[model samples]
Target: VSRGQAGKPPGGPVPSCPPSGTKLFTSTVHCTAVLEGFERLRQDGLLCDVSLLPGDGEESFPVHRAMMASSSDYFKAMFTGGMKEQDLTQIKLHGVSGMGLRQIIDFVYTAKLSLSMESLHETLEAASFLQVLPVLDFCTEFLISETTLENCVEVGRIANTYHLAAVDRFVDGFILRNFGALSQTAGFLRLPAERLERALASDSLKRCTELQLFRATCRWLRHSGSRMRQAARLMSRIRFPLMSPQELLHEVQTKTFPRFSPGCHNLAFWRASNYQMLPPMQPVLQSERTRIRSDATHLLALGGVLRQQLLVSKELRLYDERTRLWRCLAPMEAPRYQHGIAVVGNFLFVVGGQSNYDTKGKTAVDTVFRYDPRYNRWAQVAPLNEKRTFFHLSALNGRLYAVGGRNAAGELATVECYDPSSNEWTYVARMAEPHYGHAGTVYGNLMYISGGITHDTFQKELLCYDPESDRWTQRAPMSTVRGLHCMCTVRDRLYVIGGNHFRGASDYADVLSCEFYSPAADNWTSAAPMLRGQSDVGVAVFQ
Candidate 1:
C-alpha cells in the first residue's frame, strides 16, 4: 500500500546496499590507569589530610581519608560512619606500630605486600586490629604452610589466640605425628602445664612403647620444675598397663614410680606381676603396629547397589596386587549401599549411608562401624551426630571428615569429624554449599570436592578445603557435570571414577569415563575409562 516508498528504492539504482558485514569499532583503554593515578596521587601527596600516630615512637604519617576508608573497614567506620576520628585531623592507633602501618599503607595503594617472618606477627596484629582481612589471611596462610614440629606449639598458641581453626588443626596433627620425638623438643618440654596435659591426652600421640611415653612425661615434668604438683595428673594420662612386665618394673617402678598416682601403681603392678592386659593400659601404638606389619596392597569394592538390589554385599571381593586376581574376603555385617568406607590405619571404617531397602522412600542412617581385615571382624563404633546420605567421606590428618549430604530436612551443608582416638564424632566447619553425591578425596592436607548435585541440579563446582586454615576455595570446574561419583587418590594424584553425568537435557547412563586431576597443576586430564558405566560405586587404592 506504500507505493511511494517502493519507488524510492528503485530510483537510487538499488543504492548499493551495503555488503552484509559487521562494522568494527574499538576504543583504547588504559588497563592500569586507575592504579597509576592512585600511585601518582600518593607520590605527589595530593589532597592528603589526617595524620596517623603509631602506637609507640614519634613517627606519624599523613594519609588520605578516602583512600584509607576504601581499603579498611576500621578506617571506613572511623571516617565515614561518624566515629570520633571522623572530624579529628590526627588519630592515634593504640596497637599498630609505625613499621606495620607503613606496610599496610603500601598494600592499600599497590595491592602488594612484602611480608617477612620477622615482621609477620606485628603486621598481622595491626591488620587484625584494622580489620584488614586480606593481609591477615595472607599472614595466616603463610604461617600455616610453614608450620613444623619445631614451631608447632608456638603456632598452636597463636592460632588459638586468633581463633584460626585451620592452623590449630595443623598444629595438632604435627604434634601427633611427631610425638615420638616430643621429649627431644624443647618446645614440648616447655609447654605450659595446661597445654602439656592436653597434648599428652590425645590418642593420636605416636609412641612405640608405654615406657617411652613415661620417659617423655617425666622429662617434661623435670624440665618445668614448677609442674611437680601436676605429676600425678599428668602420669595418669600415660598407659602404664601397656608396658611389658619387664618395662613396668625397669622403666616406671625403678625411676619416677613414686610420682605416678596410686591407681597407676596398682595397675603397673598388676601388669608386671600378672600377664593380663587392662582396658585403660592399651597400647597407644596398637593401630600403628597393625599397619606396619600388614601388607595393604588390596583394593576392596564394598557394598553398593546392583540393578536395584542393595548389595548388603556379604561376599566382599578384593583385588590382590600379588595375585592380580580378585579374592573374596569376609562380608560386611549387613548389606549397605550408598555407604562411605575408608581405611584408617589397620581398620576400614564404614560410615553413614542409606539403610532402607525401599527404592521410593529410603532413609539415611548414622551407623558407623569398623572392620579389622586381620581379624576378619566388624565392630560398631561411635555414631554420627546426624544421619547423612550421599555425603563426602574423607580422612585427613588421621581424622575422618564427613561433609554435606542429604538429611531429614533434605540437603545439608553441615560437616562432622570423627577422631578414632576419642571414638566420638564432633562438629567442625560446615561447607559453603550443600553437596550431595559429590566425589571427595584427600591429597596431602587438603580435601577436594568435584562436580556434584546441589538443590536437585548437577553442579560444575570444584572446591578445595584446607584443614589447616579451615577454609574453602573454589577451583577450576570439572570438564563435565557429574554426581554420585567415586574419587580415589593414587600416588598423590586424584582420579574421578564413574558417575552419573548430566548432559544438560538429561542425565546420561552412569558414565564409564574417568578423569585424573593433578593438584599441583590445578588441571584435569583424561584417564583410562572404566570397564562399565557405574554410579555410587566404592573405590579403594592398593599400594
Candidate 2:
C-alpha cells in the first residue's frame, strides 16, 4: 500500500482505511463520467480521427478509434489487430444499416439504447455483424419474448442464417408449434426443403392434422421445380399410417400428390394399404413414417404454486436430459398448483389441483388437460370423478390411477382410474386409509403409494395396488414418517427423497434423510442424506 496516494487509481479516490491496511474501492460515478465524456467528444467530432462508411453509403459517422475498439470485438480486431484497416483513419463496413450503426454507436457511448420492436431485428443484424455482445444478448432476449406466430418464420430464418444455435432452437420450436398455420402462409413455400424436412421429422410439430401435414409437404416441394429432387426425403417424415382411412381417401380425392418419377404414384397405394393393415398394429409395427411424433419423452416441469404461494404459475418447462439444459415450452392454458401429472402413451395428463392463488383459501379443480408434446398443444380431457390436490396420478397398464388426496371437504380415501381408451373414470379399490401428498409410482404390475399426510399426522405405510386383483396390500414401511417428498424407482428399488416430518402442532421440519424400498427383500434401507433438506420436491428418472 502507498501511504500518500502515489498509487491512486486513475478514475478516483479511495475511502480512508487504517494506516497499515490496503483497501480497494470502485467508483461507479467515475465510470459513468468517463463514458459520458467520450460520448460528448464523439458527438462534437472532437479528438476523433476515424470516419466509418457503411457499404450502402447512406451515411457516415466520425468516431474515435480507441472508443469504438473498447466496446466492440469486431472494431477491436479491425483497429488493433493485423487487419489492413487497423492503421486506416477511414474504414469501410458492409452488411449493416446506417440507422443500426447510428443506434449502436450511441448506445456504446451512453450505455442506453432506444430499442423498439420495429427496429429490433435491424439492430440485431448490426449487433451480430459488429460482434457487439451486449446488444446481441439484448436482441436475442427481445426476440425470445416478442416472437409470435406471425413473425416466427422470419425470426427463425434469421437465427438460422446467423447460426445462433440457442436462438435458432427456441425459434424452431415456435415454428413447429405453428407449422400448420405457417404451412398455409407464403413463408412456408419459401422455406428450403432441408428446413421443411427438419420440421416434419420433429414430433414437436403441433396443431396440424396428418392430412394438413401431408399437404404441407407437397406444397413446399411443388413451390420450386428444383424441390422435387428432394421430394422423397421430405415425404418420408410424414406419419402416413396415422392418417384415418377417410383422410387417406380425401388425399386421393384431392389428387394433390404429384409423381416426379413412375414410382411416386405408389405412395398413395402403400399409404392406404399400410393404413388398413397397420392401424391396429400401430406402435408395435413402427417405422419412420408409421411412428407417431410423440413416442419420445423428456423430463417435464408442470405448473405449480410459486412465490411463497402468492401466485399460481402456468409455466411449463422441459429439461433436456442429454444437454442438461432447461427450456420453456408453451404454458398450460390455466394456472394450477399442487397438481398431479401422469403420462399415458404419447400424451401427458394434468389432473386436479388447486386454482386459487391465496394460500389461506385454496380452490381445488376436477378438470383434466392432456398435453401433446409433438405439437405442444393442450386439450381438455375427462374431468376426474372427484376433485383432488396433492394427490398421486400414476400411469400403469395403459390407464391412470388418481390416488387419495385432499379436496375442499378434506383428505379423501376414494380412488379412481382413467382409461384413455374409454375416456372415463372408474372406481378403484380404495386405500385402507386416506392420505394426501403421498408419492406414488408403478413398479412392474403394481402401483406403490408411499409417505403421505393424513390431516396433521404424517404417514409411513407403503401400500402396493394390484390392478388385476383390485387390492392394495401393505408393504414394508419407510424408516421415516413424512409427506410431500418425491419417490422414484430404479432397478426395482423405490427411492424416497426429501419431505417433512411433523414436529408438533402446525410445525414441521425438513427430512434430510432418504430411504429406498427393495421389493425382493420386502424391507427398507437408509440411503445417503441430501446436503440440503427440502420439502415438496420433485424427482424424475432420465432413462
Candidate 3:
C-alpha cells in the first residue's frame, strides 16, 4: 500500500492499506522492492486487504473524482461535439489551429485564443458580444489599418457607439482624405440645418469661405433654380442682393426657369446693385451730431470739476471727473499698470494689471484694489489669478468686467470680473481673441470691446461680452485697427477716439484714425479723425 504526501485527509480519514491479503512493504525496503512485492502478491492469487489506520486518515476519493470529471467535461466541450447548445455565431474566434471548429470550441470553453490581424474582425464581433472592451480595442486597432472610404462609415458608427473618441477621429480623417469619392453621397455631407448654420456662424467660416464648396454655393445662387428664388427672397429680407446684375444676366442667358421673369429686372435690382455707389459721405451723420452736443456738455461739466485722484504709476494719471482734478487726493496702496478702473457709489475699484518685479524676481502686485474717495485712502482687495495689462474695464450692474489685455508674457484672451459686495475676483469667460490696448464701454447691459493688437499686429475686431451669460459674441469689425484707443458713450452711441498704429521702427509715424460703433446696426462707420495720431490718450464723457 502506498501513502500519500503529508497533509490532512479530505472527508475525514486516510486509507493506510490495500484490501484483504495485500502485501505491505516496510519503510526500510527499497522503492523497487516494494513495487515488485506488491505485483508478486497480486499475481500469486493473494488478495490484498487495504484499510485506513486510525489517526492516519489522509486519503479521499471525492476531490480527485471531481477534478477528473471537470477536466473530462472541459475536454469534451472543447474538442468533441458536447457543447451543442452553446452559440458561437456572435462569439469572436481568432488564430488557425488547423481546424476552425476546434479553435472556436477551445475559446468558448477556456476563454483563450491567439491574436492576429487576419482573424481580428471575427474576434471583434465576439468580444463586443462578450463585452470584453480590451480585446475589442485590440481588434479595432488591427482593423483600423485596413479601413478605407468604403468601410469608414461603418467603422465610424461602431466607434461612436462605443465612445471610442480616438477611433472616431481616425475614421473622420480617413473620410476627409477620400472626400472626393464621397462628395455627392448624401451621407457624407448631411447634417441638421441648424448645425450647418452653427458651423457657418463659427470663426471657421473665415476659412470655409475660401473653400470650393462655399464658392460653388455662391455660384449656384446666380442661376435661376428653385434655390435661387428662395435665396433671393432671403437676401431681400436681409437687405442684400442675391446676385450681382451681371451674374443674374449671365444666369438668365444660360438657364431657363419659372422665377426668371423679365420684370424681375425692376428698380429694386438697380437700387440694390448701386447701393455702394450712393455716396462716399459719412454714414454716421446723425449720431455724430448728437455726439457733438453731448461732448460739448461733457467737456464743459468736466473742465472745472475737481475730484479724488489716485496715481497708479508715475506714467499714469487718474482722477475722478466729478471732483478734485489736480490734487494728490489719494495715494495708490498697490502697484497697477494699464488696469481697468471703475467706481461704484463712493468706492473706486481697480482690477487686473501688469506689475513690476522685486529684486528677488517676484511679482509686486497683480491684484484688485479698492479706494474710498471720501476718505482719500486706498486698500488692497482681491487678486486676479491671471495678470493683464493695457486692458479695458467697465462697470455694469454692480460688477466690474476686465476686457482684453496683455500680460508680461504678452497678449491674453482672459476676461475676469469682480464683485464689490463679495470682495472676490472670478474668471468669467474669455474673448474670441486676445486684444490689448483696446477700448471698452458699457451701454445698458452689454460691454463693447474694439480695436487692439493681435500678436504684434493691430486688428479691428469689434466684440461684445454679456456678463450675465459669461459669453462673448462678435459684432461687425471696425474699419481701422488702432491701439491705445479711448471709448465713450453718448446718447446710446459709442464713439472711439485718439488711437494710433503703434507699428514700424519709428514711434513718431503713428497715424490718426478714429471710428464709431453703432449697436443697433452692428456696424462701424468713420467719424472725424483725431486731431493728432496719439497713443496713450485719455477720454471721458459725462453730462
lDDT string, candidate 3, 18-77, tens digits: 668768767765655644554465345354322111122332111111211233453235
- Local accuracy of candidate 2 as per-residue lDDT tens digits, 133-243: 888777777777877767777777777776667778887777787787788888777776667778889877866777888887877777788877787676667776677
Question: TM-scores of all models?
Answer: 0.48, 0.53, 0.40
Q: For each candidate in the order shown, give its overall lDDT on alpha carbons.
A: 0.74, 0.79, 0.53
* Model 2 TM-score, 2 decimals: 0.53
Please give the distance, in angstroms, between residue 124's alpha carbon in candidate 2 and its true position after superposition.
Answer: 4.7
Stretches of candidate 1 off by over 4 Å are 1-33, 260-264, 267-543
lDDT minimum window of 10 residues, candidate 1: 275-284
RMSD of each: 19.9, 13.0, 24.9
Highest-scoring model, TM-score: 2
Report residue 154 deviation for candidate 3 (angstroms).
98
Q: At residue 195, what lDDT does model 3 achieve? A: 27
Model 3 C-alpha RMSD vs. true structure (Å) is 24.9
Give me the overall lDDT of model 1.
0.74
lDDT of 1 at 372: 66
Q: Alpha carbon lDDT of residue 418, candidate 2?
A: 88
